[model samples]
Target: MVTEKNNKGNQISRRSFLTGTATAAAGFMIVPRHVLGGKGYTAPSDKLRVAGIGVGGKGESDIAEFAKGPADITVLCDVHDSRAANSVKRFPKAKFYKDYREMLDKEHKNIDAVSVSTPDHSHAIQAMAAMQLGKHVYVQKPLTHDIYEARMLTEAAKKYKVVTQMGNQGASGDGVRQLMEWYNAGLIGDVKEVYCWTNRPVWPQGIPWPTTPAPVPSDLDWDLWLGTAPKKDYVNKLVPFNWRGWWDYGTGALGDMGCHIVEPPFRVLDLGYPESAEASVGSVYVDEFKQGYFPDSCPPSSHCILNFKGKKGKPDVKLHWMDGGIQPARPEELGPNERMGDGGNGAIFIGTKGKMMCGTYGISPTLLPTTRNKEVNVKQTIARVPEGHYVQWVNAAIAGYGKKEVSSPFEIAGPLTETLLMGNLAIRSYDVRKPKANGNGFDYPGRYIKLLWDGPNMKITNFDDANQFVKRTYREGWKLGS
Candidate 1:
């Protein structure tokens, strides 16, 4: 019953509240004067001096990358025994820790940077601590589990004067850079609406209610896995990867893939935040076995529609997100014969003049215009979309590369993440309201609710009740900046 509406009945309006203080906000720290020019200075280049937390699964890849060539990996941490073992094998000299705080404290002087590849919920706490210690950070996406945390991390990166990078590696891709060029150059004209869709059931779609007590793996540290989250008995249903679909630990398909799929549009358009968000989910199978996957929770298998209106930019732009293994109907722009892959987990920007198409990862993006419509030839973007994911980050970390700056810095990324997270809220509200998965609950299939964001206050004016979920209460020791 509780929604965004305030007790005073004042509604929130979505507006541009950022100070355009991107550079000032980040306070980009250059190599110190002594390190840069003084004769007595010694560079900390014996290796970049790296440490990693959550070193398993995706975290393993992060560790390996930081350990390549000229880096001294002095610290490795993971709650899981097997994952930590494999990482230790790769960098035998590195000290290992089950608690990241201990590793950071003991190895503080030896480490210059840290890579965070933890679950969605824990990103803010770990990243903030590293930044507070004057360490540069590289973290995985969706940057934080909620809008409030994303903003906090961005601000902390600024206040601490540390270089920060989110782990949406596709934002570093050449294809996405070129796609942004095309969109910005008006090759697609003034784009008003974009459809970012994907087919991502690989983590097991359509759950039919999980049963109790499958043996917990010895390798997994169940207590730590539930770090900062509510405690519950360990169950087999949420392990390996399927935790994503449930509301307790994950954000369903959109939360899982939006960072990758939405990167191109967010950067090219300079999107701030959305005016409204709503959803129509497929089905929610309830069971006692499933509790606490997605915090502030929502049902699984949903189609959500998010609408963005301009408070300072152009006009309103609508983004339709289809997942839970669903694909968008083929765009009319494509010839009837020319078809795309069925796993339609990509974005289509329907601009005023033409349309731009991009794959899920965004690098292998392409341009497609209707044969009947006028065609415009524009200069290709020279950002040089990378050939692969790891290479881009590795090159950046090595050469300290590029003149233009990384594509998805928290400035551009933070807003995009805010928009994507709205889908999570929509799902939660839908479950509370008990809306039909199809359009049956309201007059329309997707109902829209306007929200106003006060960037300075970090409050949502229109939705007072929803603001409670905007920032979650972190468990005692796991609090951010502690």
Candidate 2:
């Protein structure tokens, strides 16, 4: 029974199977699905079995969308019980676990795909583990905590041949395609500068951590939530959302919204690594006379500039990222009362001939002068993702590895995440203060320096200290790929 008959309907001997001559001499062993059920007919067992990690907040929505496709939510994992409460009710049949590690280990064979919606710090390790198990993964935006982790996960997705997508849902939106189409048609005339801004860090930033530690919530697993982050006492109001302002747990404004706002320009410009990066961060005034840096937290505001070498025959491009309510001045072409960049989070491209802008998720794309939007007609060259981002991954996972294309696969999202994190590197470097030689005060060593970057090497050639942020040393027992 181990050996089956081949295409000519001839029975294949064990010798033929061992010699790998089944295709040549005896023909194929496994029957094609079309032969059994006709074309395009999927069996019940063909439904992709999916697991959701950190199934709360955005995770809740992500899993629900996947459930709409040919997918079955088989498991859910979260560090906090309350966060998982709603998702558990939504998927009554799905098993729930507190630790993703245990769930993956126990149900590896049963699970076909994983959706990682954890915080920035834990994203890499969780996604890598699933990919290593040959499970397709859909990770949340800003794919990883550090540049090295992003690079590693990008390579792992390819090596494992698993379908992968980042939760930058905007990547799948039609707006970006329109932007690309317009750019290709030379409507923007070789963009030389891009401005992306967001009013984020809506949580606390540029402030000290609570001096008094608060007791961990009864329903939350503090240790598991910390994951690879350095051990620290629990602080009230830090969990769930406030962690976005902390360097150890989150990546500030850039990580929170850059992936969505900056993605269009990155795609349209075909930008890779930045040649150099520099930044200026706004400081918090503790009092009328005192200003503080609060190195542990992200600054209240920042303006980072990254220079990218030109592609093809275009000129070099300079990208400006502003966050924490800072925004670029209105372009002259826009009407006086008209809004810029959705009034809060948006992206604007400045080219030799014209300008174009869009809001978050690359939605609401418009050209300068407003009237050009209606007048300029461009053919859509890029294909749109059907049913949008979540379903895009759902269908791709069911299609198996390399069978379907995903919009933000790790290969593309990784470098994009790295590009955004580079702005953070510059921001963090801006806070690097050292004792002065005169001993009178401290000097900010990292300020005003244009840090040269070597993308392939993932290092700052001019600043050795800045390289430390490129990859962090995990807490002893917690390693990426463990």
Candidate 3:
């Protein structure tokens, strides 16, 4: 979930070096277990030797974090040779594999945990394989490519007694903790709805048209990059980072940024599965370059609404998600330069009493109104939140498996992830035309069916076809857990 803070505050630049472990100055923060770097370890008594799959982009930072403390980098794997090359330089003694399974089998004993930062579609397969080997996992979000895979991984994690964490580092952020604390303090008085928006109009936000085939980068192994995804000609539009807009590769906007932006409220409310999820949006354009890359698939570039029904005895909640298509009208109460909390690429929770706002990546969030409805005396007690999302995971891994609580536990993080993936399903299942009159309009916007999920069976009673898309047969050798 996204946590926003005042933009003017001392925001930690992503490129800046995180000097030390952060301490909580407010009552709502979690006391992070500080890391003593490599000095804390002596004898190897179950000290975690972790492996990393996909060491570029977010995976690069993930590897650095897990390697910081008592944990040793036992294996490094990536489809792109150069991406894996730099990681090898960092840990020269570690085994390296282009195929994740090869590393798992060859270095299984030396590895106690795996950090998975592959594309959305590969998350389940890599994570599940790691668990099958009785290895703990830290998977980036949205947890899995589809719903069935999520259930499969969740069950397998429990079955294997593995400590699991989703890479929604915001789950461990100082602002999210305060968001939950304020809710428990009845500041929002049972949030009825949340609006999450992003200016994330980058490579994945909108549908792009077809393009010419550009030369594949000499450094990347394009065939291995395709992995479980169906074979496609090497086109620039399908390479590097254009897969998110295509069905075969990425999960679009909702799948790409939902975990980061939607987590605050989902975590704080302890919201379980939604009873139903429906969507409304404009048609996506077919790209020339994507002619054979996708199965005639394109992601929407406009607004989409997703309605969710809470579990038994819980308040029904609605999530308004906006992307390339449209966005919520700016709140009129704020000043012109106020920038709707955290550069406007975040979320705001509207509750019965007041409202709260946060940024895309977790930062300390601020309470709106700064008071109760009629209480003029109330005010916000400002404070600083944690600086390092990586150290928290490193410290947990060093403390031994399942010994200390890491942020984004599978119990809460898994389901929260499942709910966001539901939005992805709604997008894939949407019937764009035939307005409300035909009972098929996504224009009702986010109004969706309540699916009766058979978690063990990995099927949805309400939407059989939708459920089928959750699990895809892997390419010959890439079959999961084989």
Candidate 4:
């Protein structure tokens, strides 16, 4: 995407921009300032004109945070007017549209960046479209609904040459940096095991889909809301929030919390793709005696183990992820009264020398034996993001791609997202059912199997059926393309 604009009133045509330019080849804006203007700017567009695609709830606050910096939210788009109301009211000068496609077509020339905070399903398409227009992008956590989309976005960021950041604010927090410093200092020596957990799925899960369809909200464009997911009737509680349980839209708990919780350990260890993944999920019963299959929704809880390759001579590392209220065993070093992971969500790193932990958003980092948090005075070797996640992206966009660094750019977030989603892939694979030849019962071959991964190729080497979850087919009308 285009980052820096030309000064001194240099002009370029749409054809020149859509095609290519020598500067674009070198990570500069192909479209000059004269070709894109509005909102009271001169030859050099000093202010970043950001257009929000999902300007509701989290989105409303996302754009609001952007506006706190040198950005003008030029357009607000949401499928539901009721949902977009707060943002619309907040930015009265910004134009409002229900369809992002129309907003982009009409407002592309005016927008310098895009912040996409839509559901997991639409994230790929909205962010892809914006990137294609040479606009910088700040996409929300988990990056995309599927591994394939995350991989695509990672490559697209480099291909488009835009400043990009995934919405994992914790990646910029001081707590994570402290953890990194401690690890680097060998306070946590040769970390071989990591545990991250969350109490998510505050929305329903491991349940059947709502059989009766609810009337679509009058102000909501239901079709647009569904985006890339297969056509389904609108149901109550799916809008505004509570879509986390369903596979067709949300990616369950792992996708929702993994990026925020896993980022700390991932960055500290400088980890990459997992070599293998496996899961043991909480099962739901049909009544009291029989276990039933509900592939439509995610399991209520799960424990996933993702094995990663260690450095040349070191032993492998195992990262454990637990959600739906499941947590790892408390460290023996801590007293019984001490809270584990801020009571519900937290991460723990176990190394050869010592252990360390942190709460959600990587906040309140602590060393085990609790008192050591103060006794061990590790120097702050890593730089902290004073501007935080949102402003960091804005400044980077202003500085242009490759000029400034972002904490969770697609290059980093893509593999991180894929790693977390591998757990979900195992969970989904665990539910795949096949009938027995005798026709007496069914066999779930996917269960109790370790999925070997070829991360570079984005495939499940051991389970072909499980590979289906790696990518998804969009609904007829939507497309995630260049």
Candidate 1, residues 1-482, lDDT tens digits: the string is 00112113322232111122122226655454345632112143334667888888898887686555456677888887886777889889888888888888898777777888887877878888887887767888888887788888878866765556778877666666667556656577677888887776457544533547677887787878777777667767566567775555666677778899877777656566666666776643445543222223334456777776653456678788877667677777687786553246778887887777777777556667444324555555333534334333333333231211444556656767777887666655423344344432222212246445454455557655556556778665577786
Clashing pairs in 2: none
Model 3 agreement with the true structure over 416-468: per-residue lDDT tens digits: 66776666665565334423442321232223554454543545567665664
Worst 10 residues of 3 by lDDT: 10-19
What ranking emerges by lDDT with the best candidate at the front?
2, 4, 3, 1
**All candidates' TM-scores?**
0.79, 0.90, 0.78, 0.90
Q: How close is candidate 2 to the true structure, as a TM-score?
A: 0.90
Computed on alpha carbons, the lDDT of every model, listed in order, comes to: 0.64, 0.83, 0.65, 0.82
**Under the 3 Å rule for N, CA and C atoms, how many clashes does model 1 have?**
18
